[model samples]
Target: MPLWSLWWAWMAGALLLAILEVVAPAQIFLGFAAGAAGTGLLLLFGLPGLAGSLPATILVFAVLSLIAWLITRRIAGVREGQVKLFNHDVNDN
Candidate 1:
């Protein structure tokens, strides 16, 4: 069986991504971690289509990652005064 067919591998990947998110805390890897977890769950449940096709599984993962990222962004929007607008370059003298 291809490595993708193994659900545990995906879960392991999710765990790694979660760890990265913790280390970075930039709200980036968490979405990917979520996607990996979702894919793992689908594989664990014996999703026939995902189990047989690498491309399809990857596509699903990408879609899930995108959706999760969008949701995360929406939930944790930019904080007030987060943006710093500078009219003059610091090096300009």
Candidate 2:
């Protein structure tokens, strides 16, 4: 019961973030949700040394969150066409 609690926390955090992402479309919360969910899956596998160190766990979370954020930005920032520019002033004859 106690050991599984940590994974539960991660899973809960992921779900919360996913909900937030839907409520607010900032495109970042989804990334966070992905990171948290991935971390939770990792922790579930009983990785050595990851579950023992608080600092390492926090660092991993931060790194994963950052990576997720970057990937989200890259995917969401795509542009297909160039903006039109004009040198003439409007209403000028």
Candidate 3:
């Protein structure tokens, strides 16, 4: 059995990432944490062929992370004035 196939490992990683998110509060690690937890659940609940390979598991994690991140971003829309675009360089003076 590969290490990556262990549901506990994924859940532990998810917990750590969730803690990091709490410490930073940037909403970045949260998505990853979600993805990890999802993977862990799938593993624990028995997903067909999920425990058979490493690449497939990783691919699932990546896709889950991306989807979670996108959903989080949409729900948490950027705050006003969060970005500052400077059209002129100060060195131009």
Candidate 4:
């Protein structure tokens, strides 16, 4: 394994998720992609502690994902009445 393989994995995951976001346009996968890419960047930049601990890296990814999700939601809120539409009975169609 390369010394920065883990980081590379994160970056690769980010790339895949980014592609997924493009294919789906759901505003979900992009957030995860951002988080993973951000984590990879942190690793690439030589952050301490995270480079040495798997658990720490996972935790960081989770935290970053959450933050990214919230930011994405804030910046691009659901379309008006989108939720109520989803809640409608499918059988009614």
Candidate 5:
């Protein structure tokens, strides 16, 4: 198959995996989907050669996922603290 077609396939597969991840609520496939999405983005940018691109994309996705997780954790922590303050009054009733 052609390179463009293969790229589209990868993107479609990534979208499907993301949807499945949502349905199953497992974080595993999300990484793979993120990697595929990164690859698709690279292809969209007209990056030459597929040899190094896939691995690079995977690495990028891994790093990004880590950062996102950390940020989410921080946000959740703050939200939890806020909830406690607001909920204390409700608990008295």
Candidate 6:
């Protein structure tokens, strides 16, 4: 397949995976979605080289996702002292 077509396919897959992530909210597929979107953008811009770009794209996506997650956690007040799993407080007072 041509480069453009391949990029489109990746974008489509990414969109689908993102939608699934939304439904599931497991925070797994978003990284892949970001990677695919980045790759699609790069392909659309007609970059100088295509070889080894997939790995680079994936790395970029992973880094970006990690940063985003950290920022979100901070904004959401997720501190190390708080229990994140199965810890719901009930108002009994």
By lDDT, who's the top model here? 3
Model 2 Cα RMSD, Å? 4.6
| Ten-residue region with minimum lDDT total, candidate 1 | 75-84
Question: Model 4, 71: alpha-carbon shift in Å?
Answer: 0.8
Pull out the clashing pairs in model 2.
none
- TM-score (all chains, Cα) for each model: 0.84, 0.75, 0.82, 0.77, 0.50, 0.57
Could you tell me how far off, in angstroms, the CA of residue 7 lies in candidate 2 after the best superposition? 1.2
Give candidate 1 regions above 4 Å deviation: 79-82, 85-93
lDDT of each residue in 2-85, candidate 5, tens digit only: 543356766887799799978986566676676667666766676666535556545655775566455545654355346534
Q: Tell me how many clashing residue pairs each candidate has.
A: 0, 0, 0, 0, 0, 0
Better of 1 and 3 by lDDT: 3
- lDDT, model 5, position 65: 57
lDDT of each: 0.92, 0.80, 0.93, 0.85, 0.63, 0.64
For 1-93, candidate 1 gives per-residue lDDT tens digits of 988888999999999999999999988899999999999999999887889999999998999988999899989968778997999999999
Candidate 6's residue-wise lDDT over 8-47, tens digit each? 7767877997898799875656656666676666656755
Query: How far is each candidate from the true structure, as Cα RMSD in Å?
Result: 2.7, 4.6, 3.6, 3.6, 6.1, 5.0
Report the candidate with higher lDDT, 1 versus 6: 1
What's the best-to-worst order under TM-score?
Answer: 1, 3, 4, 2, 6, 5
* Model 4 agreement with the true structure over 1-93: per-residue lDDT tens digits: 444436888899999999999999988898899989999989988788888887888888888988998899988977666775366776896
Give candidate 4's whole-model lDDT.
0.85
**For candidate 4, what is the total of clashing residue pairs?**
0
Q: Which stretches of candidate 4 lie over 4 Å from their true place?
A: 1-5, 79-93
Residue 62 lDDT in candidate 3:
90
Better of 2 and 5 by TM-score: 2
Q: After superposition, how far is residue 75 of candidate 2 from its true place, in Å?
A: 1.0
TM-score for model 3? 0.82
The better candidate by TM-score, 4 or 6, is 4
